[model samples]
Target: MGRNTRKRSKTTGGKVMAAAAALTLGAGGLVVVNVYASAHESSGGNAVKRSSQGSSQGGTGQAAASEASTIDCPDVGNGLRQVPDQARAEVDKQLALLDTQISEAYQRLRSSTRALQQDGNFANNAIMGPLKDKRVATIDRIATAMGRAGDRPQGLESLAACTLRASGNQSDTGGNQSDTGDDQNGGQAGNGPVAADFVDITTVQPNVTAPRMSQEASRGTFATQCGVNENKLYNSDNVIVAPGVDNGAHHTHDYIGNQANDAFASNDDFAAGETSCQNQGDKSSYYWPVLRLQDGTEEFDAQQQGGGAEGNTGRILTASEVTLEYVGNPGGKVVAMPKFLRIITGDAKAFTNGTANANAAWSCTGFEDRQLTDKYPVCPEGSSLVRTSKFQSCWDGQNIDSANHRSHVAFADPATGACPGGFKAIPQLVQRLVYDVDAPSLNDNGRSSPFYAVDGFPEQMHKPITDHGDFVNVFDEQLMNEMVQCINTGRQCQ
Candidate 1:
């Protein structure tokens, strides 16, 4: 979020704040592949397993302690829907492999779908049909593996039916055939800190629409003055690495705001920092690990490389623009966002843990009619790549941050989009990340293709369904007051 004082090579960390002291300035910061089966262990592919038991347990599933502690899973009745805990590890291992294979196949289909100009039928016949058949086979193997682990195997049908399918948006009109090989997203190519060679054409998927905000809030055009910019890379400055890492999560994150963000970063440190928010008084920071394409030739900081950091994997390009917006609670309610409040939205373990918390919206800049759920949208030329990560709007009105990082905040009910009992609604902060990556072309190889997908996140990341968001409240008392004032008065302030 700050400027680099000196130029440093890849060997020396490039352009970072000097020594965590710029006058204490601050800044800030899927899919479901559920593997919660009890099965026999099969050693193959990537040895990845996901557990929602929090960072401490090496998974990103819900941090629902109450649910975890109270679960006295009944003794196996022949028809019980749950699998035994003893078989979870082995089942998780096999499911992780399956998750990877399925995601890769989906990626291939998406690539082909775009290459064939949004021809869903063609892509399905040429790619998806076989992939689905293969998926069926994989599911059978997983079932057998789970049965061997001494657990009941009744959930295989759900797993087998969880195939990837993209809805055809009749309104989508293909991409440009031109290829200039120019890096147009303001990122430098050839010998700059930026990674990958971006194509010049901006793929536009017209008629795409943004995800629906909870009905509790209005779909008014009231937007903040915060606008969008390319230089604002939201790297992780203060977040624990994974559940167990002492410092920031094991992997590096692009963060916003200058505050200290880790277990050790005290509230005071969080309060004092430069913010990307237009209101300098507001010190909240937002962030997420950068998503990279694993094109073999890509070079990532040592931390981002897998087997190094918790929650770390892949080498993605820095985002093209980070759009930050602060909206009053959709329900027209406003409460002082309790200080030091932290809430993580989206299930990080959805891809591999069989959890259904993934709520991702993929669209092109102008494609208001064509939208894709849980998958990246292929944009036609002249349009930009866009992914929106929306957060839960309800708060429990009690805790700042929870042990599970999520239980404190719950999503509004699906039917009514309203907060549940004991929960208070707060401002809906949204992070819309736009990238330049596009559909596949004949020039690029599968592994090296410049496509955007979250599949490579650690097996624990729960790919495809893993697009998520994080938030922390460090607003100065005065700024917090202004936010309330704006909401209570129904005046849209930036």
Candidate 2:
């Protein structure tokens, strides 16, 4: 909640947007013809899958670390919902295909939606009726599935991403438009990243609103963005769109699929926060800010093509970044904003550089992003990005270690009888802070910490410091132990 950083003003029905985010899928080959008008809400999209459709290798979901142990959300279930690795692998393959298809469809709908909205001739009554009908029909199908998900609620990403597939069946708004032609013409319907489908996100849903300033700010107000993952219920995904936005604000998040734009070979594999379009001008980092308007739709705002980026990537920086007060969702679940995971990394230049370091590395690629997160987004160039650990004033290894020593307790190894050295167990109190409130958690949705999960999760983690949210309660020993138990024994998880 840095007041100085968040200068933008936004007022939405008096709801304060803490650190919220939204998401938008790349358009291509996706065909979501029906639009629903029901207010019946569901949670999250399907689990992210990897594709095998293209000649390209399956976009590896996060790489599995044999050394890494999955934190059993014991409260979530008695290991009943956990899918076996083999089954999980198959899911990844299917997800990859779905991602590709959706990417294509995303491009298509984006165009159609924009045309219907921007084209003065296209009236809401004429276009929106069919759209609403389709939306309603689709929502019914989605609602039925949600009803079937049973009492064990699924992750918001999974529920939101219902399995909707399209075989590039619909006619693109810009008929016969291909990638090369769109690029040569520039700003044509297909000029943006071509989706398997047609249109950009804005056109289809004309009234779609991104996240805005909290009313809290307007009274000459103040605010906070992502907290220390304290509140489990709120985050970008948990948002319930207003009653009028998407046909009475249908809550069933309908999704087609996804694609891996990870063009960098040195890419650490695809992760959501970074840009895929190779910067032509050659800069260190691409600023892609995932934003959400009041309506609850998501979109990508990236570095200026003027700064060597591409497409609306340049036009997007209008708000750039802004922190807000608690939007209700303490940290994860239903954040008021659109998307999660703010930046790709602290080091701008070497995101692809430390590809040489096998011990621990950061990645921008979708597949590689999985395992690297445990170590966090460090690059060979170190922390050069602003407002991150890499910043000049930020602590070095020694200082960081010292801070941990002062604030944290020794991590006791379960297998061994001794406590960890130079390492501290993430006090259960702090687990939510590190897991839910940190930068990665703040800006990410879909899969858990697709990154982050590394070697010493429950037993030892980074000390709560600058990176942790402000809600860290030093005196809350009981709360801390609760968190510690959650970390060590996976207790009281829901």
Candidate 3:
């Protein structure tokens, strides 16, 4: 698919990435009518249903127009200024229908790939083309229903345009993010050998280090019941916006355990969220950057303008599988974690800094000994590719939020995986990510082939070893206590 840059407002400060676009879309504006259709379908009936409540404000305009919103479109806001209740209802119904139709089409397309080329053509015309028109029409109806008609353009494009113009930040695009952070750096130049330049991981096996701590090196272990989080579900607003910014991660994130991922979500929210963990009492919420393929296809395609998920500029897809494992103190001694504590493991900017920041674990099925650094393995037909993230397990006795994220907690010793002398030992959390993709080869034509890289990630990611992990501890007090107990006593609890 062609890549389209999204129209973004400079006022948001953060660069316009796929995640940010998703945040904008999720914040309000255009509703994703077709994204969740399959999730709400009735097995015995053809009728589609809505899953979330209406808008939260209980008023009209874009505020009350989201698929998961609870607010009702009010009769106010003058004509064309706000979405009406009746129109909102109608648009929502159509969106649900669109979801069902598109999902069915995708399912059919997935049944075979014998004619990859022919199938691709059919997907574009028979599926994508019609879906695009329906989406555009749905946006138009929203504008017309709100009385915006000619005043506002089709899709949320109109809403975004107005927002940018009103903010007067259109000309204020001077603040480009500095390259110091991992998000900006593409890897240090002339530092070490580029992991990608190597052939397969096996060739460089001796150079790579497997990120594993033997039981003898640790006090205990915290194991997770579910090795992979495969359910097609996501909720962005559940988490808080970035530290100073109003919107959280700016993109939609797949969340498991605690459903309430929003910043404003409290310990109570964690307690109340539905969990997929074997232990229902474990209400810890795990999250990470949603992985997208180079072509912009994600596990759940939102079909928004651009590609991938809604608001994304490329075709991005969710990882084939995300393994949620509880990081237990491999030493068998566990310390309690402070409430609301947050930590990011593996550097998101590793691609820019090189191996020093790249401590993630990676391997492909069948080829075990050949560890990987920056290179991805091109597996044979029946192999599995996987990525693992091990979080820092040592924490300072005090403080949850810190100026330097790493300062609050530190990694255990590599030799023993033991907490430092004064630091507290907490359950280490690791996210083992698996994808159904392999390394790209030179023989592919037209588009990049075999090796599927993440959309928007740096070039290093294209090589495969750039895989890193990110995390936040949104576990409630009760869950943390249980983890501490299990780790401290050397008990292996799933």
Highest-scoring model, TM-score: 1
**Model 2: per-residue lDDT, tens digit, 230-338?**
2111111101111111111101111100111111111122122222112211111111121111121122312211111122221111222222221111111111111
Arrange candidates by TM-score, descending: 1, 3, 2
State model 1's lDDT.
0.43
Please give the lDDT score at residue 282 for candidate 2.
14
The local distance difference test score of each candidate is 0.43, 0.20, 0.41
Worst 10 residues of 2 by lDDT: 65-74
TM-score for candidate 1, please give it.
0.53
Question: TM-score of every model?
Answer: 0.53, 0.21, 0.51
Q: Which run of 10 residues does model 3 get worst, by summed lDDT?
A: 161-170
- Candidate that would win on lDDT: 1
- Which structure is stronger by TM-score: 1 or 2? 1
Winner of 2 and 3 under lDDT: 3
Q: For model 1, what is the alpha-carbon lDDT of residue 254?
A: 57
lDDT string, candidate 1, 236-289, tens digits: 332411221222232345566544444335455566655666667767767665
Model 3 over residues 1-494: C-alpha lDDT tens digits? 12112221111111111111211222322232221112123212222222232233211122112111110111111112223333433333333333333333333322322332333233333443454465556545545644532233233532221100000001111233232111111112111112232244444455445446565433445665532445544433213213312122323445565554554454555556677666776566676555443333343434431123222223344566666655555454667777667676654334322233345556676665565554445556667666667778899887563422455678877656677778977777867666776454433221134224432122112333344444445555676777777666666665
